[model samples]
Target: MSSFNRFRAAGPSSLMASAHPGGDSPALRAVRTLRDAASQPRMMIAQPFGPQGERPESDPARAFGANKPHPTAGWIPPTALAALINGLRRWIRLRALKIIDEIAERRMIDRTRTLDSSRHVSDHLLEQLPVPVWVEDESGRLVHHNRAFRALFRREAEALIGRSVAELLPETSDSIPVETRLDTGERRLDVIIGRCRLTLPASSPDFRSIAPVGGRIGTITDITERKEIERRLRELATTDDLTGALSRRAFFAAVEQEAERSSRYGSKMSLMMIDLDHFKQVNDRFGHAAGDRALKLAAQAMVEGLRDIDALGRMGGEEFAVLLPQTSLSGAIEVAERLRKSVAAIAIPVDPHPMTVQLTVSIGVAERLDDESDFDRVLSRADAALYRAKDEGRDRVVFDQPRHRDIFPA
Candidate 1:
């Protein structure tokens, strides 16, 4: 029989099956792989890999194509070769695209997870902050608050979030938005009696320079105790520690201001200079402790007898001054007489002495003239009147004018 007829009778599959009957054999598997890789379904053909344009001596294709009249055993018809080449190109293109897509998908997933992890860590840090911290959106709605903020305002996350930032903060926080617009980047420290609210400028991103920041982070510092200390310090500077009255410097400053007002507006204002009668004797006989008690008693009495608009200040030892706003000369004399009687009525008991010590005050009264804006002049006039009262007698009220003594029987 002719070679072509013989090869046709023994098909390629039968030849492969007869040589390697076992389906799982390595050679059978290699042959199957080559066949599947070289062609699409319904067009599959077995083709052996070999040298360029030539079949290797041991190539399986030799037996199949050997009978062909073509001189080269590796030769394939143009149509079948084109089908095989096109199939390989299509498979490579589709597989490469699929691999590229898988790589891109994995990268995107990793990026998303990384961002989520970073967000969680940052949120935990904000939650653990010591100072009251808050986050708000551009609409001024509260987004998040730290534990400190919740404790200070006594609100839960559910209650605060999505609400207006204005509602979460005190009315004093209004300045924050206004000042934020100024964008000077200065701290705004608003202190109330029990609560001091501090908003840090740099940390908070409220609207743009022209807008309130919708998602802004800010801190609120509690300075209530600090504010209270400052207020006490201010009081210590301007007030007398011993007598609870205005100190000499503070009293003069106040009088100077009032004197200017009196001169400009032609308002009535008066002053009094008082010297405790026989104060030296009391200090000598009862000791300084007893003298302090006497002084405290006298101050308490004067404070109780004076009007709210009046001010009392200790000039020095055994001497005191009074500022009476909106008072005339006659009015000043009446107040001085009343104070004298009140001081005279104070009876301090000394333990060792076992006796009630009686004291009196000599007062000098002066009225601020319409044209005189200098309070030092008014103070000098009151001092001179005080000397006259001391010269004439110990326990009487005298004025800067002549024959202005008034006495009451006790």
Candidate 2:
């Protein structure tokens, strides 16, 4: 048998002997059976008695030369009882240690999760920012910068942190002139920094700029792309793709805007509606391609005839419009006559035979009145004058007078 099994076998037997004072207790038999079947001494440790007629730590009765006197008919073994108490103590200690270990492990896990969550949240905020932002202390020392700023500068966040703004950006070191004051009460430049070229050590030139406000806040936006897109969109919306003349929608919108500005600024603004004469016949005689060439030629002539400040737009089919800001009614009519003569003089070359197409335009001009703010009323007057020009015969310019019924019927 193994050492533990032997210990187990002897344990309850020893207990049974202790229990039987006269060596004949009834409980002695039951305790003996427990010791014989147990696999380990520890398992038999739960028995309930000490050695018979001996203390818990004493040798066996045979070695001690002890003989038991009969006392009680039924008694528990003292060795078994002592062993049970010791086993209970061991179990309690093990359970307490297990509980402590679990608590420590749980606390460690919670700490790690808290740190990870904080870092994740911080990274997300940096990436989502729309504008470049950087924070610095009162001493102009960089403390925090978002991802936008890092990407633009091509630098790491760690390298920039704790560095002085002046030290990191030598070009902008003197940007804060002597007159401006930062939030830290130190004098610095308060103006926006424009794009300045920078030559790197081993590469072509790069651009850098800054928008530092105070020691604490800085924000910047690269306006190069924004400006370019805005310029292109404006050109497409206003100017005709083929002839470079303003579109119909842009023409009326300009008239309305000019009217409002004139009323507010106490300036005169005029509108001229022009139509090409015999434009349909040109297309009917030649192909549609020839007609397109004639329209482009007429538009160019009208543009050359007007002032740079005057706005002209193509109003679909053969009609066009002109907006004259700060111009009088007579001046508007004179300008329309010039445009008509210019179109009549254009010799549009469209064929291999060197044939030139002749064209003339009819015009209607109207100036804004003192109380005129309604765009619809102004346009009606201009249209009426245009019909009058065509009625009196085409190839002529007509001006509309400000009338009560023309503006508002009584």
Candidate 3:
């Protein structure tokens, strides 16, 4: 009988474990199985036969399997079949382990590449920003700053790196969108600072539901020029260019506001209408240039005589107006008299010669009534008083007197 047949008759234990003196460990069993399978005869086949000598119509040896060409067809040995099945099982297990390892390695490589790409993009974006930008870590230390940031501080990026934001900009706040002033030598910079917290993407496996890892990112902008322009615009809108007093429109607006306040609180307020006496005669004799000088001089004197709470404005040509808050009719008359004296004291020099000219003012005073809220009503009464002042004399103050209404027509 062949060795294959003899081994099969003895059973599976004889092929796997019985060959080793010490019981078969898994590794030893695997080795012995492979070794035994290798030692089997190369030529072997399986064939079916009937009990009585008879030829089957189908070929009996066709189904038999072997690793090599057989000299004669025969039944396949059971031990050979067992060894082939065991070898196939081992090959499948090894292939599965190799595939799992490959997948794990590929995932690690992809993660690394993604991280590198993200870091490169972040650095490039920060570098290209025009405004000063910086990032701080959780400990409030500046971890990164852009080129603009370095330029703003007038220092090298290397020197500023790893420094705390508090050390560099003492007034910078962690809260967003604040305006601050920085005095750098002779220049004053108006800086606006905005802040935001940095966070990792939600797709990252390391993402946490709590606060982000990095502290905050900040941006700064200089607005000094913008602020200066705004100031100049306000001045132009509120003041007259020729005399530097409130413009006619601005003065009327102030009168309306003061009238509303007086009516609301039952407080006393007064208005004065002033006219430069013989202003037209001065312009005709000395020319318009001299008239302009006289007007400016008159405005200056009036400004100097008035209190801080009083507002003065050029109404038109030679007419001017003053608003006095918390003042009575008598008090308005006193201020008007002082202003008239101040204007009379000014002696303006005519151009192209040593000749000088003097000017005087006529002022009319009227107090706002608690029942009358309209500025025009108070202004009309003051205008009537001014006509009276001019009729009586050129340089004097006149107060509006109360008039009684006639119940029946004369």
Q: Pick the candidate with the highest lDDT.
A: 1
In the predicted model 3, the residue pairs found to clash are: none
Residues 1-410, candidate 1: write the lDDT tens digits.
65644544454455455443454434344434444443332332345354565567676557656423543123234554455455445546766888999999999999999999998998898889898877666776776678998887788778885786456556554243423335566545443423454544443434453234546666776666775788899889988877777889999988998888888888899999999989888888888988989888998899998999789998888789999998999999999999999989888987576788899999999998765678887888888889889999779998886333222111
Report the C-alpha lDDT of model 3 over 1-410, residue by residue, as the tens digit: 76655654554455444333355434345544544654554555334356653335464443433333654324445665565576546656766888899999999999999989998997898898888877666676777788887887677978887786557653652333422334422222233333322111111222122223746666665655665677789879988878888999999999999899999999999999999999998899899999999999899999998889889998999999999998998888888989988999998899668889899888888888766888887888888778889999779998786561122111
For model 2, how does the per-residue alpha-carbon lDDT over 253-311 read when each residue is reduced to its tens digit? Answer: 88888888888998988888899988898888887889999888888888888888888
| Model 3: number of backbone collisions | 0
How far out, in Å, is residue 194 in model 1? 6.8
Identify the leading candidate in terms of TM-score: 1
Compute each candidate's TM-score over C-alphas.
Answer: 0.65, 0.52, 0.62
Residue 13 in candidate 3, Cα distance off native in Å:
23
Q: Identify the runs in model 3 with alpha carbons over 4 angstroms from their true place.
A: 1-35, 42-214, 282-288, 404-410
Q: After superposition, how far is residue 107 of candidate 3 from its true place, in Å?
A: 8.5
Selected candidate, larger lDDT, 2 vs 3 = 3
Error of 2 at 170 (Å): 13
Minimal lDDT window, size 10, model 1 = 401-410
